[model samples]
Target: MLPSAIVSMTEFPLNSNGKIDRKALPAPEFTMERCDKVAYVAPQSPAHITTCEILASLLGVDKVGLDDNFFVLGGHSILAMKAIMAIKQAIGIDINIVNLFEAQSVRELCVLVDAELLRKQLEETEEFEEEGVF
Candidate 1:
Protein backbone atom coordinates (compact mmCIF):
# COMPACT_ATOMS: atom_id res chain seq x y z
CA MET A 1 0.00 0.00 0.00
CA LEU A 2 1.32 3.38 -0.99
CA PRO A 3 1.52 6.01 1.75
CA SER A 4 -0.69 8.98 0.83
CA ALA A 5 1.18 11.43 3.06
CA ILE A 6 3.88 12.36 0.53
CA VAL A 7 3.45 15.46 -1.65
CA SER A 8 5.40 16.51 -4.77
CA MET A 9 6.60 19.97 -5.83
CA THR A 10 4.29 21.65 -8.34
CA GLU A 11 6.35 24.41 -9.96
CA PHE A 12 9.45 26.61 -9.74
CA PRO A 13 9.08 30.36 -9.92
CA LEU A 14 10.31 31.87 -13.21
CA ASN A 15 12.46 35.02 -13.50
CA SER A 16 11.54 38.14 -15.50
CA ASN A 17 13.14 36.88 -18.77
CA GLY A 18 11.36 33.49 -18.53
CA LYS A 19 14.50 31.92 -17.08
CA ILE A 20 14.46 29.63 -14.02
CA ASP A 21 15.29 31.45 -10.77
CA ARG A 22 17.34 29.61 -8.17
CA LYS A 23 17.99 32.25 -5.50
CA ALA A 24 14.68 34.08 -5.25
CA LEU A 25 12.57 31.30 -3.67
CA PRO A 26 12.63 29.33 -0.52
CA ALA A 27 13.88 25.72 -0.55
CA PRO A 28 11.25 23.37 -1.97
CA GLU A 29 9.93 20.73 0.41
CA PHE A 30 7.61 17.75 0.07
CA THR A 31 4.39 18.05 2.08
CA MET A 32 3.52 15.24 4.42
CA GLU A 33 -0.05 14.16 5.10
CA ARG A 34 -1.27 14.27 8.67
CA CYS A 35 -3.96 11.97 10.00
CA ASP A 36 -5.74 12.45 13.28
CA LYS A 37 -7.41 9.05 13.55
CA VAL A 38 -5.88 6.32 15.72
CA ALA A 39 -6.68 2.68 15.03
CA TYR A 40 -6.78 -0.25 17.43
CA VAL A 41 -4.82 -3.46 16.86
CA ALA A 42 -4.91 -6.81 18.62
CA PRO A 43 -2.63 -7.56 21.53
CA GLN A 44 0.80 -9.14 21.03
CA SER A 45 0.84 -12.95 20.67
CA PRO A 46 2.46 -15.10 23.37
CA ALA A 47 5.13 -16.65 21.14
CA HIS A 48 5.83 -13.34 19.44
CA ILE A 49 6.17 -11.62 22.79
CA THR A 50 8.57 -14.30 23.94
CA THR A 51 10.70 -13.96 20.81
CA CYS A 52 10.69 -10.19 21.15
CA GLU A 53 11.92 -10.47 24.71
CA ILE A 54 14.66 -12.87 23.67
CA LEU A 55 15.75 -10.78 20.70
CA ALA A 56 15.68 -7.52 22.63
CA SER A 57 17.66 -8.84 25.56
CA LEU A 58 20.10 -10.71 23.37
CA LEU A 59 20.37 -8.21 20.49
CA GLY A 60 20.52 -5.13 22.70
CA VAL A 61 17.45 -3.21 21.61
CA ASP A 62 15.36 -0.74 23.63
CA LYS A 63 12.98 -3.38 25.01
CA VAL A 64 11.13 -6.60 24.29
CA GLY A 65 8.20 -5.13 22.41
CA LEU A 66 6.40 -7.48 20.00
CA ASP A 67 5.26 -4.66 17.70
CA ASP A 68 8.87 -3.73 17.06
CA ASN A 69 10.22 -4.46 13.60
CA PHE A 70 13.22 -6.80 13.50
CA PHE A 71 15.26 -4.70 11.04
CA VAL A 72 14.20 -1.45 12.68
CA LEU A 73 15.30 -2.93 15.98
CA GLY A 74 18.78 -3.34 14.42
CA GLY A 75 18.76 -6.95 13.26
CA HIS A 76 20.73 -7.93 10.16
CA SER A 77 21.86 -10.96 8.13
CA ILE A 78 24.77 -11.72 10.42
CA LEU A 79 22.44 -11.62 13.41
CA ALA A 80 19.98 -13.79 11.56
CA MET A 81 22.69 -16.33 10.79
CA LYS A 82 23.67 -16.36 14.42
CA ALA A 83 20.00 -16.68 15.35
CA ILE A 84 19.64 -19.80 13.24
CA MET A 85 22.67 -21.36 14.88
CA ALA A 86 21.37 -20.47 18.31
CA ILE A 87 17.91 -21.77 17.52
CA LYS A 88 19.26 -25.07 16.29
CA GLN A 89 21.40 -25.52 19.38
CA ALA A 90 18.53 -24.53 21.69
CA ILE A 91 15.64 -26.26 19.91
CA GLY A 92 17.44 -29.15 18.17
CA ILE A 93 15.98 -28.33 14.77
CA ASP A 94 17.43 -27.20 11.47
CA ILE A 95 15.76 -24.11 10.04
CA ASN A 96 16.53 -22.19 6.90
CA ILE A 97 18.31 -18.91 7.60
CA VAL A 98 16.43 -16.98 4.92
CA ASN A 99 13.21 -17.43 6.87
CA LEU A 100 14.34 -14.76 9.32
CA PHE A 101 14.29 -11.94 6.75
CA GLU A 102 11.24 -13.25 4.88
CA ALA A 103 9.40 -13.57 8.17
CA GLN A 104 10.39 -10.06 9.22
CA SER A 105 7.86 -9.61 12.01
CA VAL A 106 8.21 -11.45 15.32
CA ARG A 107 4.77 -13.02 14.94
CA GLU A 108 5.70 -14.59 11.61
CA LEU A 109 9.03 -15.74 13.00
CA CYS A 110 7.21 -17.37 15.92
CA VAL A 111 4.99 -19.32 13.52
CA LEU A 112 8.05 -20.66 11.72
CA VAL A 113 9.71 -21.56 14.98
CA ASP A 114 6.62 -23.35 16.24
CA ALA A 115 6.30 -25.29 13.02
CA GLU A 116 9.93 -26.35 13.19
CA LEU A 117 9.62 -27.37 16.82
CA LEU A 118 6.59 -29.48 16.15
CA ARG A 119 8.28 -31.07 13.15
CA LYS A 120 11.31 -32.04 15.19
CA GLN A 121 9.15 -33.45 17.98
CA LEU A 122 7.20 -35.54 15.53
CA GLU A 123 10.34 -36.84 13.91
CA GLU A 124 11.77 -37.88 17.26
CA THR A 125 8.53 -39.59 18.20
CA GLU A 126 8.48 -41.43 14.90
CA GLU A 127 12.08 -42.52 15.37
CA PHE A 128 11.28 -43.86 18.83
CA GLU A 129 8.27 -45.77 17.51
CA GLU A 130 10.30 -47.20 14.63
CA GLU A 131 12.81 -48.63 17.13
CA GLY A 132 9.83 -50.27 18.94
CA VAL A 133 10.66 -48.32 22.08
CA PHE A 134 7.09 -46.88 22.29
Candidate 2:
Protein backbone atom coordinates (compact mmCIF):
# COMPACT_ATOMS: atom_id res chain seq x y z
CA MET A 1 0.00 0.00 0.00
CA LEU A 2 1.31 3.43 -0.92
CA PRO A 3 1.03 6.33 1.48
CA SER A 4 -0.87 9.36 0.23
CA ALA A 5 -1.66 12.70 1.76
CA ILE A 6 -5.25 13.67 2.46
CA VAL A 7 -5.33 17.34 3.22
CA SER A 8 -7.85 18.51 5.77
CA MET A 9 -10.48 21.04 4.81
CA THR A 10 -9.80 24.46 6.32
CA GLU A 11 -13.50 25.21 6.68
CA PHE A 12 -16.83 23.52 6.07
CA PRO A 13 -17.67 26.09 3.38
CA LEU A 14 -21.28 26.39 4.30
CA ASN A 15 -24.01 28.99 3.77
CA SER A 16 -27.33 29.79 5.46
CA ASN A 17 -28.95 27.12 7.66
CA GLY A 18 -25.72 25.16 8.12
CA LYS A 19 -25.49 23.13 4.91
CA ILE A 20 -22.40 22.28 2.95
CA ASP A 21 -21.48 24.33 -0.12
CA ARG A 22 -20.35 21.54 -2.44
CA LYS A 23 -18.69 24.00 -4.81
CA ALA A 24 -16.47 25.53 -2.11
CA LEU A 25 -15.74 22.25 -0.33
CA PRO A 26 -12.44 20.56 -1.02
CA ALA A 27 -12.23 17.12 -2.61
CA PRO A 28 -11.94 14.17 -0.27
CA GLU A 29 -8.66 14.03 1.53
CA PHE A 30 -8.38 10.35 0.67
CA THR A 31 -9.13 8.25 -2.39
CA MET A 32 -12.07 5.85 -2.48
CA GLU A 33 -9.81 2.97 -1.49
CA ARG A 34 -8.41 4.87 1.47
CA CYS A 35 -11.85 6.14 2.45
CA ASP A 36 -13.29 2.63 2.35
CA LYS A 37 -13.56 1.29 5.88
CA VAL A 38 -12.25 -2.24 6.04
CA ALA A 39 -14.22 -4.71 8.10
CA TYR A 40 -11.12 -5.86 9.98
CA VAL A 41 -10.37 -2.30 11.13
CA ALA A 42 -13.63 -2.02 12.99
CA PRO A 43 -13.81 -2.60 16.76
CA GLN A 44 -16.64 -5.11 16.86
CA SER A 45 -14.49 -8.07 17.83
CA PRO A 46 -15.55 -10.45 20.58
CA ALA A 47 -11.95 -11.01 21.67
CA HIS A 48 -11.39 -7.41 22.71
CA ILE A 49 -14.62 -6.98 24.62
CA THR A 50 -14.34 -10.40 26.24
CA THR A 51 -10.82 -9.71 27.41
CA CYS A 52 -11.80 -6.37 28.93
CA GLU A 53 -14.85 -7.87 30.56
CA ILE A 54 -12.71 -10.64 32.00
CA LEU A 55 -10.39 -8.06 33.54
CA ALA A 56 -13.31 -6.17 34.98
CA SER A 57 -14.75 -9.37 36.36
CA LEU A 58 -11.49 -10.31 37.99
CA LEU A 59 -11.33 -6.85 39.51
CA GLY A 60 -14.86 -7.39 40.84
CA VAL A 61 -16.06 -4.08 39.55
CA ASP A 62 -18.53 -2.55 37.14
CA LYS A 63 -18.68 0.60 35.05
CA VAL A 64 -15.37 -0.50 33.69
CA GLY A 65 -14.68 2.63 31.77
CA LEU A 66 -12.33 1.93 28.90
CA ASP A 67 -9.98 4.43 30.54
CA ASP A 68 -10.34 3.24 34.08
CA ASN A 69 -6.96 2.47 35.59
CA PHE A 70 -6.59 -1.13 36.69
CA PHE A 71 -4.89 -0.32 39.95
CA VAL A 72 -7.44 2.31 40.82
CA LEU A 73 -10.05 -0.37 40.44
CA GLY A 74 -8.48 -2.52 43.19
CA GLY A 75 -5.52 -3.85 41.26
CA HIS A 76 -2.22 -4.37 43.05
CA SER A 77 1.30 -4.82 41.79
CA ILE A 78 1.09 -8.61 41.74
CA LEU A 79 -2.31 -8.55 40.14
CA ALA A 80 -1.19 -6.04 37.56
CA MET A 81 1.81 -8.13 36.59
CA LYS A 82 -0.27 -11.25 36.53
CA ALA A 83 -2.91 -9.67 34.37
CA ILE A 84 -0.28 -8.29 32.04
CA MET A 85 1.21 -11.73 31.61
CA ALA A 86 -2.19 -13.23 31.03
CA ILE A 87 -3.06 -10.60 28.46
CA LYS A 88 0.25 -11.01 26.70
CA GLN A 89 -0.13 -14.75 26.51
CA ALA A 90 -3.76 -14.67 25.48
CA ILE A 91 -3.72 -11.63 23.20
CA GLY A 92 -0.06 -11.33 22.12
CA ILE A 93 0.48 -7.93 23.70
CA ASP A 94 3.38 -6.84 25.86
CA ILE A 95 1.33 -4.66 28.11
CA ASN A 96 3.29 -3.07 30.91
CA ILE A 97 2.26 -1.87 34.31
CA VAL A 98 2.94 1.66 33.18
CA ASN A 99 0.45 1.28 30.33
CA LEU A 100 -2.24 0.34 32.81
CA PHE A 101 -1.52 3.50 34.80
CA GLU A 102 -1.31 5.67 31.72
CA ALA A 103 -4.38 4.21 30.10
CA GLN A 104 -6.91 3.71 32.85
CA SER A 105 -9.92 3.08 30.68
CA VAL A 106 -10.63 0.10 28.46
CA ARG A 107 -11.28 2.49 25.57
CA GLU A 108 -7.66 3.63 25.51
CA LEU A 109 -6.47 0.04 25.44
CA CYS A 110 -8.39 -0.80 22.29
CA VAL A 111 -5.75 0.89 20.17
CA LEU A 112 -3.06 -1.27 21.72
CA VAL A 113 -5.14 -4.40 21.18
CA ASP A 114 -5.61 -3.64 17.49
CA ALA A 115 -1.90 -2.96 17.04
CA GLU A 116 -0.92 -6.18 18.78
CA LEU A 117 -3.32 -8.22 16.66
CA LEU A 118 -1.95 -6.66 13.49
CA ARG A 119 1.64 -7.22 14.55
CA LYS A 120 0.99 -10.84 15.47
CA GLN A 121 -0.70 -11.45 12.16
CA LEU A 122 2.26 -9.92 10.33
CA GLU A 123 4.70 -12.08 12.24
CA GLU A 124 2.74 -15.20 11.42
CA THR A 125 2.61 -14.25 7.77
CA GLU A 126 6.35 -13.69 7.69
CA GLU A 127 6.96 -17.06 9.29
CA PHE A 128 4.73 -18.77 6.79
CA GLU A 129 6.45 -17.05 3.89
CA GLU A 130 9.87 -18.08 5.16
CA GLU A 131 8.71 -21.67 5.51
CA GLY A 132 7.14 -21.56 2.04
CA VAL A 133 3.85 -22.62 3.55
CA PHE A 134 1.74 -20.66 1.08
Candidate 3:
Protein backbone atom coordinates (compact mmCIF):
# COMPACT_ATOMS: atom_id res chain seq x y z
CA MET A 1 0.00 0.00 0.00
CA LEU A 2 1.12 3.57 -0.66
CA PRO A 3 2.18 5.71 2.27
CA SER A 4 -0.62 7.83 3.67
CA ALA A 5 1.56 10.61 5.03
CA ILE A 6 5.17 11.75 5.36
CA VAL A 7 6.56 12.74 8.72
CA SER A 8 9.60 14.97 9.19
CA MET A 9 11.60 14.80 12.39
CA THR A 10 14.00 17.59 13.26
CA GLU A 11 16.26 15.07 14.94
CA PHE A 12 16.12 11.38 15.63
CA PRO A 13 15.36 10.38 19.17
CA LEU A 14 18.24 8.66 20.94
CA ASN A 15 18.24 6.11 23.72
CA SER A 16 20.58 5.93 26.73
CA ASN A 17 22.92 3.79 24.64
CA GLY A 18 23.16 6.62 22.04
CA LYS A 19 21.38 4.56 19.42
CA ILE A 20 18.17 5.55 17.66
CA ASP A 21 15.23 5.10 20.02
CA ARG A 22 12.52 3.45 17.95
CA LYS A 23 10.07 3.38 20.84
CA ALA A 24 10.52 7.07 21.46
CA LEU A 25 9.65 7.90 17.88
CA PRO A 26 6.45 9.81 17.46
CA ALA A 27 3.48 8.01 15.95
CA PRO A 28 2.57 8.87 12.40
CA GLU A 29 -0.56 10.95 12.19
CA PHE A 30 -2.84 9.53 9.52
CA THR A 31 -4.60 12.64 8.41
CA MET A 32 -6.60 13.08 5.25
CA GLU A 33 -5.87 16.80 5.26
CA ARG A 34 -2.34 16.29 4.00
CA CYS A 35 -1.67 16.84 0.29
CA ASP A 36 0.75 14.42 -1.33
CA LYS A 37 1.00 16.20 -4.66
CA VAL A 38 3.43 19.02 -5.44
CA ALA A 39 2.67 21.67 -8.04
CA TYR A 40 5.25 21.37 -10.81
CA VAL A 41 7.37 24.41 -11.71
CA ALA A 42 9.20 24.19 -15.02
CA PRO A 43 12.91 24.98 -15.10
CA GLN A 44 13.78 28.33 -16.71
CA SER A 45 17.43 28.00 -17.77
CA PRO A 46 19.78 25.26 -18.97
CA ALA A 47 21.47 25.12 -15.59
CA HIS A 48 18.08 24.92 -13.90
CA ILE A 49 16.97 22.14 -16.23
CA THR A 50 20.13 20.13 -15.64
CA THR A 51 19.90 20.53 -11.86
CA CYS A 52 16.24 19.51 -11.88
CA GLU A 53 16.97 16.47 -14.01
CA ILE A 54 19.83 15.36 -11.77
CA LEU A 55 17.78 15.79 -8.61
CA ALA A 56 14.78 13.93 -10.05
CA SER A 57 16.93 11.04 -11.28
CA LEU A 58 18.73 10.72 -7.94
CA LEU A 59 15.58 11.01 -5.88
CA GLY A 60 13.71 8.53 -8.10
CA VAL A 61 11.02 11.04 -8.94
CA ASP A 62 9.27 11.45 -12.29
CA LYS A 63 9.62 15.25 -12.19
CA VAL A 64 11.27 17.89 -10.06
CA GLY A 65 10.57 21.62 -9.94
CA LEU A 66 13.08 24.46 -9.92
CA ASP A 67 11.84 25.55 -6.52
CA ASP A 68 11.52 22.11 -4.98
CA ASN A 69 13.75 21.67 -1.93
CA PHE A 70 16.01 18.63 -2.13
CA PHE A 71 15.91 17.66 1.54
CA VAL A 72 12.16 18.17 1.65
CA LEU A 73 11.91 15.71 -1.24
CA GLY A 74 13.58 13.01 0.93
CA GLY A 75 17.20 13.68 -0.04
CA HIS A 76 19.96 12.67 2.37
CA SER A 77 23.74 13.16 2.48
CA ILE A 78 24.44 10.05 0.38
CA LEU A 79 21.82 11.04 -2.16
CA ALA A 80 23.21 14.57 -2.17
CA MET A 81 26.69 13.23 -2.93
CA LYS A 82 25.30 11.07 -5.73
CA ALA A 83 23.38 14.00 -7.15
CA ILE A 84 26.45 16.29 -7.01
CA MET A 85 28.60 13.63 -8.66
CA ALA A 86 26.04 13.17 -11.41
CA ILE A 87 25.86 16.93 -11.95
CA LYS A 88 29.65 17.16 -12.11
CA GLN A 89 29.90 14.30 -14.59
CA ALA A 90 27.09 15.66 -16.75
CA ILE A 91 28.00 19.36 -16.76
CA GLY A 92 31.71 19.37 -15.73
CA ILE A 93 30.98 21.51 -12.67
CA ASP A 94 31.80 20.61 -9.09
CA ILE A 95 29.19 21.93 -6.64
CA ASN A 96 30.32 22.12 -3.06
CA ILE A 97 28.31 20.01 -0.63
CA VAL A 98 27.95 22.90 1.83
CA ASN A 99 26.64 25.12 -0.94
CA LEU A 100 24.18 22.40 -1.95
CA PHE A 101 22.90 22.19 1.61
CA GLU A 102 22.68 25.97 1.86
CA ALA A 103 20.80 26.25 -1.42
CA GLN A 104 18.47 23.29 -1.47
CA SER A 105 16.35 24.30 -4.48
CA VAL A 106 17.27 23.62 -8.10
CA ARG A 107 17.08 27.30 -9.02
CA GLU A 108 19.44 28.22 -6.18
CA LEU A 109 21.76 25.36 -7.06
CA CYS A 110 21.87 26.47 -10.69
CA VAL A 111 23.03 29.90 -9.64
CA LEU A 112 25.81 28.38 -7.53
CA VAL A 113 26.82 26.08 -10.36
CA ASP A 114 26.98 28.96 -12.81
CA ALA A 115 29.16 31.00 -10.48
CA GLU A 116 31.48 28.07 -9.93
CA LEU A 117 31.75 27.42 -13.65
CA LEU A 118 32.52 31.05 -14.35
CA ARG A 119 35.15 31.07 -11.63
CA LYS A 120 36.79 27.99 -13.11
CA GLN A 121 36.79 29.51 -16.58
CA LEU A 122 38.36 32.72 -15.30
CA GLU A 123 41.04 30.77 -13.46
CA GLU A 124 41.83 28.75 -16.55
CA THR A 125 42.04 31.91 -18.64
CA GLU A 126 44.47 33.42 -16.15
CA GLU A 127 46.64 30.30 -16.16
CA PHE A 128 46.68 30.19 -19.99
CA GLU A 129 47.68 33.89 -20.14
CA GLU A 130 50.50 33.22 -17.68
CA GLU A 131 51.74 30.39 -19.93
CA GLY A 132 51.59 32.80 -22.96
CA VAL A 133 49.08 30.52 -24.72
CA PHE A 134 46.57 33.39 -25.12
Q: What is the TM-score of each candidate against the true structure?
A: 0.58, 0.55, 0.68
RMSD in angstroms, candidate 1? 7.9
The lowest-lDDT stretch of 10 consecutive residues in candidate 1 is: 32-41
lDDT of 2 by residue, 1-134 (tens): 12345557667888786898877766655343432232222235765675576676777754344545555455676766776777777776776677755665566666677776788799999999999998
Model 3 clash pairs are none
Model 1, 13-116: lDDT tens digits are 78999887867656545331121121212336554455555676666754544344566555777777877777666556677887878775666777787898
| Model 1 lDDT at residue 29 | 50
| Better-scoring candidate (TM-score), 1 or 2 | 1
TM-score preference between candidates 1 and 3, better one: 3
Top candidate on TM-score is: 3
lDDT of each: 0.62, 0.63, 0.81
